[model samples]
Target: MFPYAAELIAYAAGAALLTAVGGRGLLLISGLGVAATLGVVGPLLARALRGAAAAPQPAPALT
Candidate 1:
């Protein structure tokens, strides 16, 4: 959840900055920021999810 939220916030901020700047250089900068955010967040999210899935579970008792 944190990763997803962070990704969303980063993307929104990047978009807003790009719109406000309205220039080729800023566009490139904003694009790099977005890509970097995703590059970091994506692996963290994947690892967290994988860890959750790998957690131990108790076995069911038979009657």
Candidate 2:
């Protein structure tokens, strides 16, 4: 799976930069919202995938 967390962090950093350039509070809030959602979802998906990765999969027995 792609690193959604990294993408979200990039988006947040970009937004912060833009907000600073424009001195806009609304942009900051919007960026924060996007970052927060990404933070919540990325870990949840990673945890779900981690379980799958740890599951026992059928493997050929080497004789």
Best by TM-score: 1
Residue-pair clashes per candidate: 0, 0
lDDT of 2 at 54: 100
- After aligning candidate 1 to the native by TM-score, how far in Å is the CA of 11 from where it should be? 15
Q: In candidate 2, which residue ranges exceed 4 Å CA deviation?
A: 1-23, 58-63
Q: Stretches of candidate 1 above 4 Å error?
A: 1-22, 58-63
Q: lDDT (CA) for every model shown?
A: 0.89, 0.85
Q: State the displacement of the C-alpha of residue 4, model 2, in Å, after optimal TM-score superposition.
A: 26
| TM-score of each prediction | 0.55, 0.48
In candidate 1, the residue pairs with backbone N, CA or C atoms under 3 Å apart (3 or more residues apart, or in different chains) clash, namely none
lDDT per residue, candidate 2, 1-63, as tens digits? 369988999889877777676647657777899999999999999999999999998998999
Report the CA-based lDDT of candidate 1 relative to the real structure.
0.89
Model 1 poorest ten-residue lDDT run: 21-30
